[model samples]
Target: MPFVYMLQCADGSYYTGSTIDLERRLSEHQFGQGAVYTRDRRPVALVWHAEFDRIDEAFGWEKRIQGWSRAKKRLLIEGRYAELAGWSARQRACRERDG
Candidate 1:
């Protein structure tokens, strides 16, 4: 199975990725061999993960989550699906206003 996963880094930032083997990928991240973003952060913890039947599905999900705001990602990690729409709308509104 393929999986989309999120790691909470030591600096309170998040990293999102997809992998066929979650454990091995996570181990690599821990050892500073995973991602450049995560390598500097160090000491990351698996905060969220979802399994998919296909690697492409997992990769797609990873891309989507990578674009989310920290608050939105937190809501996802906490399983607060109800608030996601509101947060997403707020984010969009902010982006539109800023631009």
Candidate 2:
């Protein structure tokens, strides 16, 4: 199964990715053989992940999650799906109010 995963780096930043082999990908990231972003922020820990039927689906989810706010991602990582839409609504309102 392909998966979309999020890792919390040692610096407290998040890295999102999609891979068919979750364990191998994580190992690569740990050893600095993964994405440069993860390489720079080594000693990452897997925080959230969802299995998908296809690679493209996982990749699509990866891209979407990568664009989310830290707060939104936190909601996800914490398994608070009910609050996600509310957070998005709040964010949209903030953007519109600021502009």
lDDT per residue, candidate 2, 1-99, as tens digits?
999999999999999999999999999999999999998898999999999998999999999998889999999999999888857757789978999
Give candidate 1's total backbone clashes.
0
TM-score of each: 0.88, 0.89
Could you give candidate 1's per-residue lDDT for residues 1-99 as a string of tens digits?
999999999999999999999999999999999999999999999999999999999999999998888989999999998878857767789978999
**Cα shift from native, residue 10, model 1 (Å):** 0.6
Report lDDT per candidate. 0.94, 0.93
lDDT of 1 at 17: 95
| lDDT value, candidate 2, whole model | 0.93
Q: What's the lDDT for residue 13 in model 1?
A: 94
